[model samples]
Target: MSPLALGALYGIVTIIVMCSGMPIAFALGVVATSFMYFFMPASSLDTITQNVYEEIASVTLLSIPLFILKGAAIGRSPAGRDLYSAIHAWLSKVPGGLGIANVFACALFAAMAGSSPATCSAIGSAGIPEMRRRGYSPGFAAGIIAAGGTLGILLPPSITMILYAVASEQSLGRLFLAGVGPGVLLVILFAGYAVYRARKEYRLAHEIYSQGGIKSAYLDDEHFTFAQKVEMLPRVLPFLILLIGVMIALYGGFATPSETAGLGALLAIVLIAVVYRMWRPRDLMPFLNSTIKESCMLLLIIGMSLLYSYVMSYLHISQSAAQWVVALHLSKWLLLAVILLMVIVLGFFLPPVSIILMTAPIILPPLREAGFDLIWFGVVMTVVMEMGLIHPPVGLNLFVIKNIAPDIPLSDVIKGTLPFLLLMFLAIILLCLFPGIVTGLPDLLMGAR
Candidate 1:
């Protein structure tokens, strides 16, 4: 078959298999192996095994597990709760204080956790209940956390950015720096919305109660003494310092990504031990077990995604698709919009890792052809994926919120996320209008990619 025919067939088959509910790794492997066996020569087949091994055995990919472990250790300990408390205490004087605090906490926690579901679980477990107890709408609390959790993959030390770096052969440090600006922008946008919603909702609730209607109480003001705020920071400072240390090490060229991750993981363990005093096997093993299982799953998916990409390339499908895309001669901006939409649709099904590994090669060529900066595109793609995480039917973060706050209906969680979802799109538009928001920090810090 021609490359176009092969590309169409491969996509159709892959989608059908993936939609059949098979594990993504297996589905990719099965489709790749079958396509190679039936459509390509047998002599080249041994390369599949070799490629899978080599693709995953990178020093850079080594950092994924360590970073994941770092997230898991602190995620399983009291770190997230303490961190949220510290931020919450400081934000006590603000309207929609809890909501704003949750967004900020998620951003800080995102740097540590690097996983959306983990960020949601960590912050939501503490923040959601407090919001609920203070009479904030359950939907509002769940939505805030579910939306905030999406930050985990956007901030520095993010696994998604790391995966994008490896796939695009971009600098991990630069990508990390690049993310800082847009990530902060998103945090601001999300928090500003929180403030807006809080004031509106609280005023409405107050008006109802004034008429003897007794509507729900909105925790409009959560006062805290300076001493109380300072006290919470002591517990939160260690993890914040760890995050700062790891980023400086990466950006300053003090260490390789793997080395930095190793140190970060080590420090995370020690902090949990000293601060949370979780030294026992019982305390650490669950984190270890969870990390190992998650790491293995991701590595498997990565290995197979490489194989799938190879199959597309071997079939000349990737090159053909790129050629086809470029041949359209559309404006780069229009082409980029198409690419962004494609990834958003993919995000509805696949996790970020699989999406990056499987699609980056095929899409980057066209993006580069359009003179687009791959690093900037990576941030834009990540933000779009963040939107998918809170979207319906398969939004992982949405389900995470429901799992953590069971009494909050899934419908309510989805509804709550709608506003933040709009904020994410706005973030994307801002990045497009001012590509500098995504690129300026990295270029200033590292002199551009």
Candidate 2:
């Protein structure tokens, strides 16, 4: 069979296997191994062993587990509650303060956690109940936490970015740097919308009560005294130190990504055990076990995807597909739009890691041939994947928020995310219009390489 025919067959088999509930790593490995056994030359089989060795031996890839460990340590610590309290106190005077605070908290936690579900669970567990008690709509409260949690992937120290960097053979530090501007843009958009929605809804509720002459008991914000605010600083300072330390270490050329991640994990463990005094053998064991479990899952997927990638390369399928795409001579922006739309659709079904691993090998060649910057594209792709976390059927953050706030109907949570979802698209538009949003910082800090 022709390579293109074989590639199409492999693609169909993959989709079927995944839809049939096979784990992604297993699905990829099964399909690739099957293809290799039946069609490819037996001599070409050695590539699988080489691919596994290369992927496992990667120093850059080491950052993934370290970052995961760092995130797990912080997520398992008291940092989430403290960070939320401090941020809530500071932002209490603002309209939609709780919701806005949730956004800020998620962004901060994302810097440490590097995973959306972790961010959602950590902040949502605290923010949702408070918002609900404060007379905020359940849907609105759930939406804020769910949408905000996506920052975990777009922000620095992102696991998705690490995977992309390794898959695309781009600089890990530069990709991390590139994410800053887009991440900030998304945060501002989400926070601004939260404030607007909060103020508008609050006004409507008040007017309704006044017109009906009904007595309403709304939860009032705590007015922390200046001294009280000062006291909250201790709860937050350690997190700030970790965040700043990791950023400086990565961007200042002081350490490689892996080294910085190790440092962050170490600091997180120390803070949890010593400063917070929340560490116990029971708590510590679970946290360590969870990190190991998650790290193994991710690493296994990476290894399997490497095997699949080897298959694609051996068949020359990726290059042929790239040439086929280029032959159409589609306008670059048009092609980019199509590619991103496909990514967004895939997000509804696949996790970000699977999406990046499965698609990057096929798409990156075409994207690079069309003169797109891989680092910038990585940021853009990360932003698009952020949408998937809140999208339906398989939107992981939606389920996460639902799990945290079970009383909030799934539909309401989905409704609350709609506005933020639109804002994500707007952010994407702006990024495309000004590629600098994704590239500016990286170029300045890393000098265009």
Candidate 3:
């Protein structure tokens, strides 16, 4: 069969298998292996094994598990609650104070936990109940957490960024640094929208209470004594310290990403034991198990997806597709728009890492040839993928919110994320128009590595 035909067949079969409820790792592995066996040389089979091994053996990949461990350690502890409490105390007077606090808290927690689901679970578990108790609409509360959780991937120490670096052969540190400008931009947008929505919602809530002849204490400001605000600091000090320490280690030339991740995980454990007093061996078991399970699952997906990318390379599919795309003589901006739109469509079904691994090798070559920087493209891809987390059909963050707040209608959670989803798109557009937003930090700090 022609390479084009083979590539087409591969895409169709893989999507079919994925839609059949098979795990993405297994689906990709099965389809890739089948194609390799039938169309490629026997030696290519050997190459697949070696490729999977080498991908798994990557030292950079070590950071993923360690970072996940750090996230799991904090997730299993009181850190989430404390972080939310501290931020909520400070921001409560702002419009939509509780919701706005959730956005800031998610951003801070994303610094420690690189996984969106973990960020969602950590903050949602604490923020949802409080927001609902304070009379925030269920959909609004769940939607904020779901959308805010996406910051975990766009912020520093992101596992998705690490995977992109590995797959694209980009600098891990540079990509991490590249994420900062866009990450901060998205946070501001989300938080600003949260405040606006909260202000409007608060007013409506008060009106409803007044009509019912009930005093609405929920809209009242939480007046914290200066001393009370000071007391809230200790609850969040450990997380702040970890966040600052990891950022210093990463951007200050103090440690590699892997080493920094190890440090963060160790500090998390110590905090759980010493500060939270959850040091018992039994208390630690769940964190360990959760970390191991999640780490293994991600690694397996990485390994299998690498195998899939290899198959595309062996068949010369990626190069052919790139050549075909370049041959279309499309304007650079138009081509980029098409590629990003394809990514958004894919996001409805695939997770971020899968989207990056499966598409980067194919789309990136054409992008580079079109004069786009891979580092900037990486950040753009991340922002696009962030939309997938809250999008329908398979938006992982939506499902996560559902699982956490089972009582909240899934439709409401999905509805709530619509505005934040548009905010993500705005961030993407800003990045496109000003590539400096994505590349400035990396160039300044990492020197265009």
Best by lDDT: 1
Higher-scoring candidate on TM-score, 1 or 2: 1
Error of 1 at 25 (Å): 0.7
Cα misplacement distance, residue 155 of candidate 2 (Å) = 0.7
Clash number for each model: 0, 0, 0
Which whole-number lDDT from 0 to 100 does residue 296 have in model 1? Answer: 97
Question: How many pairs of residues in model 2 come into backbone collision?
Answer: 0
Prediction 2 TM-score vs. true: 0.97
Q: Model 1: C-alpha RMSD to truth? A: 1.2
lDDT of 3 at 51: 88
Across 1-449, the per-residue lDDT of candidate 2 in tens digits comes to: 77778788888988898899988899999888888888889876767777777876788888889988999988977789889988998888877787789999999999888889999999989999988878788898998999989999989899899889888999888899899999999889999998898888778778878788554434344587878778999878978888999899889999999999999999899888877785778878878999999999999988998888778878877777777888889899999998999999999888998889888877898889899999889988988999999989899999999898888899999999999999999999999899998989989988965
Q: Note the residue pairs that clash in candidate 3.
A: none
**Candidate 1 residue lDDT tens string, 193-233:** 98998888888888888888876757344578888888888
The collision pairs in model 1 are none
Q: List where candidate 3 sits over 4 angstroms from the true fold.
A: 209-217
